[model samples]
Each structure stands twice: as C-alpha cells, then as structure tokens.
Target: MKILLVDDEESLLRTVQLGWPEPDDEIVTARSFEEAKRSLLPGRAGDFDCIILDLQLPDASGTTILSEVRKRTDTPVIMLSAWGDTQFRADTLMSGADDYIMKPVGIRELHARTLKAALLHRKRSSPKPSVIAIGNCEFHVQAQLLKGETHTTKLTGAEASLLEELALANGEPVLRTDLYLKVFQREAQFGDKSLETYVSRLRRLLNEHTEDGAAAIRTIRGVGYRLVA
Candidate 1:
C-alpha cells in the first residue's frame, strides 16, 4: 500500500520512515501544506491508499488538507496531533478523517490503525466506472480501448489514465501539473515533454475514431488541456 505522511517535523518523518513495520509499503513525506498540496493534486489523490496528516502544520491546519483530500478521493485519512482536546478530535472526524491518533503514538499501533482504516475505506467505497463515452467513441477504461463505428485502438496505461482524468472533468480544464502527476505518478521536472507526446497521440486517435469536431482535446495555453466534445 502507498501512504502519504504530511508533517513538518523532520524527526517524526525520519522515525516513521525508519520504523515502518511493512517494509514493502511505500511512504511519501511532505513537510508543509504547499508540499502536501502538490502531492494531493486533483487527479493524483487516488494514487495513495491512505494519508497520515499532522493536525497542525507550519503553514495551515490539518483540517484544511483534509477538506482537499475529501474533495478528490475517499482514501482513508488518519489525523495525528499533539493536542488531545476532545473538540479538536471531534472536528477532524466531522471533517471526513477516518481515524485520529494522538502524537507520540507507538509504531505498532500506528501501523495497525493505518491498515484498519484503509481496509474499512476499501470495503465502503464504490468502484469507478469501467467504460466512458467520449463523443462518438467509447472508451473502455479498464481495457484501455477506444472503440468507434469502424475501428478500435488500444491505448497505453498512461494514455488511458490521462483520458480518464479528462473525461472525469467533463470538459473543464485539467491542470498540466495535475495531469503529469496523475499519469506519470511523479512530480514533473523542468522541460518534461512526455505529457505533450501523449496528448498528441490521443488527438490522433480521437480524430480518427470520432467525427471531425465531435471530440477534441484543446490546449489551454500556459494552463492545461480540456476535452471538448
């Protein structure tokens, strides 16, 4: 399982990374609200199985991050705080946090709670749609297929995920940074053109499968791309 740990304390981040019981589980750390926002970009939130957030941060409150997380994905969130105030705990829970753990929590207990919260979330969450209709063509999300009246094209996993994000937006612009992170599963470096290459390929497929102006991806200069259908 992939987990995101958001906290400003270098010591706590180091301790969690070093003492994490499941060696195979991947853990990503963010030191501030800005860093956490980048990691939790709109289309990228589903990449993590769970998020462990510090209730207090230097830049913003943990509940602020929790609100953003709830807007994107239903992934489990466990709030960690030094404060033991009942009202604080109740507020976090009311704001969609799946669990709350007081600071100075033992590694074993933290591990157990993390697993339990994630498991419960999975059982309660609904599955995403397997197929999406894009203008005159049909996209089989799981199969990575684009089907039209006379032809069908297969797409790479990255292409399919990129398309899925755009489709989910329902024609609204999707940020370039958000697309790059969601499709590539990492932060984009300067001058990365991989996303552009995928966009060009998808445009070609769309033109060939759909009517001339039925479906298209428009570039929002200096911003991102939007699907117009």
Candidate 2:
C-alpha cells in the first residue's frame, strides 16, 4: 500500500518515513499543502491508500486541506495534532477525518492505529451481501463482475467497488468525501488522478452493458456522485 505523509515539520516527516512499513510499502513526503496538492494531482496521490496529516502547517491548516480533499476523494485521513485537545479531535472527526493521533506517539502505535483505521474504514464501506443489483444489473462482489439479463462483463477492482458503493447507497447520493474514503481509503494527493480515470473507465464499461449509458452513475457536480436505479 502507498502512504502519504504531510506535515510542515521536516524532521517529523523524515522520522515517519524512516520508521514506515517495509520496502514493499511506498511512502511519499509533503512538507506543505502546496506540495501535497502537487503530489496528488491526478495520478500520483490517487494511487495512495493512506494519508498521515499534521493538523497545523506552515502554509495552510490541515482542516483546509481536509475540506478540499472531501471535495475530490474518499481516502482516509489520519490527523496528527500537536495540541492534542479533545475539541480538536471532535472537530477533526466532524470534518471527515478517519482517525486522529497526538504528537509523541510511538512508531509502533502509529502503525497499529493506522492499520486499524484502514481496516475499519474498509469494513464499514464494504457491501453487506456478496451480490447486489443496480438498475437491473447484478454485481457479484467477489467475482468483480456485472451481470445483465443477456450479458455478463468483468469489471476492474476499482470499477466494481465504485459500483458497489453506489448500489448499496440505493440511489442516494454518496458524498465525495465518503466515496474517496471508501474507494481510495484516503484523499488523493496532488499527483493522483486515478479516481477520475477509474470513474471514466467504469462509465464506459457500464454504458456498454446498459442502454441508459453512463447515466446510471450521475455526477452530482461539486458534491460527489450517485448511482441511480
């Protein structure tokens, strides 16, 4: 899994990077919101599965970034605060953060917390059933496929997941914040564009299977998206 570490403190960023998961796990460091923004562009951060963010920054508040992030992606945000106030924690949660941690936390504890948050978020987002129907189309979650009356087609992991989220919402608009959290596990960094790309791919594939074209998943514009029945 890929992780993005965002903080204004250079030493802290380096410390987290050095103590991060094994070599197989990729890590990216951003010292400011601008840097983080640049990193998550469309492709870079879109691929990341987790984000470790500091509440205070030299350029902008993490909450500011959180608001912006909620507009585009659903990747989990683990907020790190030096202040460590209970109100701050509550505020972070209210602002759409997945988890919050205080400074002076050990590497092992941070790792454990991050892992737990990711797992919980994934669990909460997962569809209850192995299969579900969306506008006359059946989706097999385990198989990652869409089945129609006369057609069956494979879907990419991301596409299947996006569809499943919409179908589970039962046509209600799933907020972009939730979508980013459920699908990407965290906010897309400055360079990550994979979210949009995957949506386009799913639209094309869904269009191929249904006469309604891509309208099954409607773009809510400035909000998020919805899967209509």
Query: 1-229, model 2: which lDDT tens digit per residue?
Result: 6778898888887777788666576778889999999866765554667788888989999899888777667778889887866555665776788888888778778877777656655655665788776656777878999888788998877787887877767666777756665687665456676767877887777777777757778889877888776
Q: Rate the local accuracy (lDDT) of all candidates.
A: 0.84, 0.76
Kindly report which residue pairs in candidate 1 clash with one another.
Answer: none
All candidates' TM-scores?
0.54, 0.54
Best by lDDT: 1
**CA lDDT of 15 in candidate 2?**
79
Candidate 2 deviant stretches above 4 angstroms: 130-229
Q: For every candidate structure, what is the RMSD over all alpha carbons to the true structure, in angstroms? A: 15.4, 13.3
Candidate 2: residue 162 lDDT (0-100): 80
lDDT of 1 by residue, 27-87 (tens): 9999999999888897899999899999889999898889989999999999999886766
